[model samples]
Target: MRISELKKKGLESLKGKWGKAVSLMLLLFLINVILPYIVEVIGSGGFVQWFDQEGTPLWSDIFGTVLSIVLIPLTIATTWFYLDLVRKGNPEITEVFAIYKDGKTSLKLIGGSILQAIFIFLWSLLLIIPGIIKSIAYSQLFFLLRDHPQYTILEAITESRKRMNGLKWKYFLMNLSFIGWGFLCLFTVGIGLLWLIPYIGTTLAAFYDELIVLQEDEQPIEG
Candidate 1:
């Protein structure tokens, strides 16, 4: 629960398992590229058609709608994948996909993703600050779900809320702390940005695991 301890552990995990972290980032990038491109092609005018068209194509709009539907689940899978690496120190890039390979996990990711998306989107309407707060607030929901797959969605969400209490500011600062790394990456003309995403992501994942995950079977008892 100590932020300093979490930050230290995250740094250590990053130093020890950077290669796998990088691979995960690469996979995410590839997926980001492919899904949009694929969707564009499936659109009425085709991927390139939108560029020349006066207005957006019907297909493009449809693609956007469909993507909205799929994005949540993908987000969940990525969250779990990254956290697994952090928690176990065993970096398996495929763990994310492995979860999706099963129908139940896939559905769970989709459900959680959609719900979070809506929550985040609503929070954003209050102003940008609330949006960021919501992001950090819901950030650990995926990790909770990953660790306790048996729990209902509502249960996992409630746990995230509890753990995040009085610590949202701390989590936000931790997240903000990555901005320097991001800026450094940008200074390299985005060459470093590619690596930065994975590096920062794994580091954050490590931070969450160390600070929030319970290693013992029994809950900590009050004095």
Candidate 2:
């Protein structure tokens, strides 16, 4: 589907489910924002900012390294929660906490996430373009991890790279379609984010779903 169609259908699907949608965004907001705020009030700026204060070189800098470690799990949890909604058509706020309930899978996800950051960072040293390409390459890592937590870190990253083959531009355009909403969220001092977050999220989830379904249809049938 085109990016516009995905966003249109995604919001249409969200019409009556505003309650769950808001709740899901709120949960994510707390982890990414409130936790940082708490640290900022009690000490220096939180994770990302605190690292920025140091004079590390941008290329080898551990800023993204440290930041990725923090953000990746949140990313995983958010992806899994929304993918569940995508599958079940019901949004349970508790889905946000579902990641914590797992010990083994969580560890594996963290490992996979760090490797993702490392590979991207290494590629980035050669040229920023390669880094961006690698970013798109691994874009589906967490989503793949969601259904296949059994996948090892290497396997998860490998499969995400495979899943994204020939489809990066579509995903790129899909994300590009949200640029206006992103700026609007900034203008609102983030008030717009509550809606914008779920809007973009579900659309991406929809994109992933569309890809998975397309791949399934293309597979040679079993005997």
Candidate 2 colliding pairs:
none
Worst 10 residues of 1 by lDDT: 214-223
- What lDDT tens digits, residue by residue, belong to model 1 across residues 1-223? 5655666665565665677767766666666666676666666456466566677667667776776666556656665656655666574766666665678877887787777778889999999989887877777777777777876666666677666667788887777777887878777976676666655666667766666664324442221
TM agreement with the true structure for every prediction? 0.78, 0.79
Highest-scoring model, lDDT: 2
Q: What residue runs in model 1 are displaced by over 4 Å at the alpha carbon?
A: 1-5, 38-50, 123-131, 214-223
